[model samples]
Target: MKKLSPEILEKLKGIKAVVFDVDGVLTDGKITYDNKGMEFKSFNVKDGQIIKHLRKNNILTGVITGRDSRVVRNRCEELKIDFHHHGIEDKFNVFFKEMSRRNIAADQVAYIGDDINDLPVLRIVGLSATPADGHYKVKEEVDLVLSSEGGKGAVRELADLILEATGTYDLILKKQ
Candidate 1:
């Protein structure tokens, strides 16, 4: 894949909101079931911190997962994600809503996704990013392909790039 384009980087700099697709982009794309049928997902601590950093800088962040689970809801709550849309078969709806609610236009939004289901939003968003583990079709359509796999700090990587471009990453990290 081509390296991230300078044009793409410039576009990412204007992002005031970031959105992600959950099961894959946030959880390594693996679904585990317990004896009682409870579902579980693993989220990176660093990703959480990145989201906090973005929010602290007045940038809005949220999630739109295809599956519905308390685990996702809890994670969103922990991250203080304002627009949580789970069990969304149609990602564009949630995507458009979040953009409108945040008062951020499509050109000012970046979306991280991992599979064919994410193609629509990825195609329309200004900056589209895919994890290393994303499906081939999804990667083909994205503007940037991350070196890290989803749920393995991919979100953090994307967040860092966006924050850096916006010139707010260092400021946020100074508090750490």
Candidate 2:
């Protein structure tokens, strides 16, 4: 994980929710097709653990993806995310509705994205982040540029920062 600056650390303190983009943020931005025309995507268990840890500590976690897939649904189910809105044309639409429904302010949310479509939500969130391998535009716009690539603990890095900012990381560590 990269060292978070004091300003970024302060911003993270207000974060109560974290939203993610599935394809490039959760997976390695790869979509493999088999001869049988089945699609496959690999996800990191470390990322799953991070999500579980955050939720256990009362941080809301959610997913918003432009693409819909059974794999994504399964992964979100396994993580037990608070919100799972996928296959939307405009991500910010779902973002606003969900946040309003949850009574969470824009400053209380953190959004991680890796492409142009993620810009809208990322620009509005309290703490915006992107993976090391994220697109140039996305990287340039994010508050935190992670050291880890997608599907390789990028979410874990962000979760660790959030846990640390909220003074809950050590508590989770002690329980282990």
Candidate 3:
């Protein structure tokens, strides 16, 4: 992980929720379909574990993606992430609505995105992050760009950073 500046750490330390984009942020930005029209998406096991850890520690987490898929829904269900909003034309609307419904302020949210469509919510969130292989513009706009590419532990890296910033990573590790 890169050394985070004091300002960035301060922002991350305050994040109570973490939202993600699906296509690029959760997967490798690839969409595969069989001749029968069944779609397949690959996810990182490490990332899934980190998400579970975040939930265990009482940090809110969810997904907001432009595309909808049963695979994503199944994954979120397995992770027990109830705040996901998929197949939305306007991601910012879902972000805002979900946050408002949960009574979470913008400054307490961290949004991880990887494309142009993610820019709106990323811009307004407290800590905006992207994968190393994210879109050029998205990378340029993010506060933290992980060394790991999407679907290859990027979310795990972010989860570790967030836990570390809030002084919970070590505690969690000790307990485990």
- Each model's TM-score? 0.94, 0.97, 0.97
Clash pairs for candidate 1: none
Clashing pairs in 2: none
TM-score of model 2 vs. true structure: 0.97
Tell me the whole-model lDDT of each prediction, alpha carbons only.
0.86, 0.91, 0.91
lDDT at 153, model 3: 90
TM-score of decoy 3: 0.97
The residue ranges of model 3 lying beyond 4 angstroms of the native Cα positions read none
Tens digit of per-residue lDDT, candidate 1, span 2-26: 3567897798788888898987788
- Please give the RMSD of candidate 3 to the true structure: 1.0
Better of 1 and 2 by TM-score: 2
- Choose 1 or 3, whichever is better by lDDT: 3
* Model 2 agreement with the true structure over 1-53: per-residue lDDT tens digits: 24778899898888899999998889999999899988899999999999999
Could you tell me the lDDT of residue 92 within candidate 1? 90
